[model samples]
Target: MKKPFIFIISVLGVILESCYYDNEVYLYGNGSGAVCDTATVTYSATIAPIMASNCNSCHTASSGNGVITSDYNNLKTIVNNGKLLKSVNWTAGAIQMPLGGQKLPTCTLAKINKWVDNGALNN
Candidate 1:
């Protein structure tokens, strides 16, 4: 009887532990619980590094499908044409980027959009 009771209690404890829920915002936010910082986004600081890490591998001069994003001028072309945001945002009618990979994080997409809205400046 004792052995059976202990086993049942252990199983119930495990089940309850597995059902714990974490708040999405809390899990992804800054220490103070603030969300993404899109306030001062810039090309060289924000957008360029994002592209380098997530896009330039295949979108560079030698390999892109006529879409070289390794430099500001080439990147501006895509930004101007709307392919950059469309692809990264996985919007319809646009080829999803980092092809065969997951969409960029929401914060990253937000920063890119902010940069574009600010004119996709070379700064």
Candidate 2:
């Protein structure tokens, strides 16, 4: 009686936990995002979405390396790292963000590169 209920509860808990874990990126690096400038660095609306959608998972300031992609400061590091516009953007090496999201599109990549080349202004 009690044992049966306990077993059912445990199984249900496991299933629910698994279902709660979501790694899917709802939005990809769509350069169509709105623009928001922060003065020093141009926080390309499109760029933040991609980072938020992909890198923020493990690179948040509170996480391991405290690498927060919440803004352009951290994002510039990406360009300086030589992987900003590359297929695999990361500091040490290829990180392939969003864990398993689709590869960033060329237009999106080019947008990021252009924004950086244009002084990375926050406009």
Candidate 3:
């Protein structure tokens, strides 16, 4: 009887623990219950790194994807035309970015929007 009770309790505890919800912004503290700073979103400082990590892999100049993100000029073309925001934001009729990967974090998306709203500067 003791063994059976202990086993049941352990299984219940495991099930409850597994049901608990957690995510990066919640645990690491950024998008939720923490600051998502978009105050100084610059090309070199902020936007460039984002593109390099998320976009440049497949959109490189040599990749012939017709969207070269490795350089500022090429990137600017899509930025100006609104493709960047649409794709990343996963807005209707726009192709989702990272092409089958998960959408960017909320904080990251906010930073991109901030950069774009600030004239998508080359700085």
Q: Which number leads on TM-score? A: 3
Candidate 1: 10-residue stretch with minimal lDDT: 23-32
TM-score of 2: 0.48
Model 1, which residues run further than 4 Å from truth? 1-34
Better of 1 and 3 by lDDT: 3
lDDT of 1 by residue, 19-121 (tens): 8746434344434546777767888999889999998999888898899888999999998898888998899998998799998887777788879989999
- What local lDDT score does residue 79 receive in model 2, on the 0 to 100 scale? 63
Tell me the lDDT of model 1 at 80. 87
Return the TM-score for each candidate structure: 0.72, 0.48, 0.73
Identify the superior model by lDDT, candidate 2 or candidate 3.
Answer: 3
Write down the RMSD of candidate 1 (Cα, Å): 11.2
Candidate 3: regions farther than 4 A off: 1-29
Worst 10 residues of 2 by lDDT: 21-30
Which residue window of length 10 is worst by lDDT in model 3? 22-31
What tens digits encode model 2's per-residue C-alpha lDDT throughout 37-111? 222224556667767766777777778264556777786776676655553442355666545776665455555
lDDT of 3 by residue, 1-123 (tens): 699999999999999999875643344334566766777789999998998999888999788379887788998899989999999999999999989899998889888887888898999
Sorted on lDDT, best first, the list reads 3, 1, 2
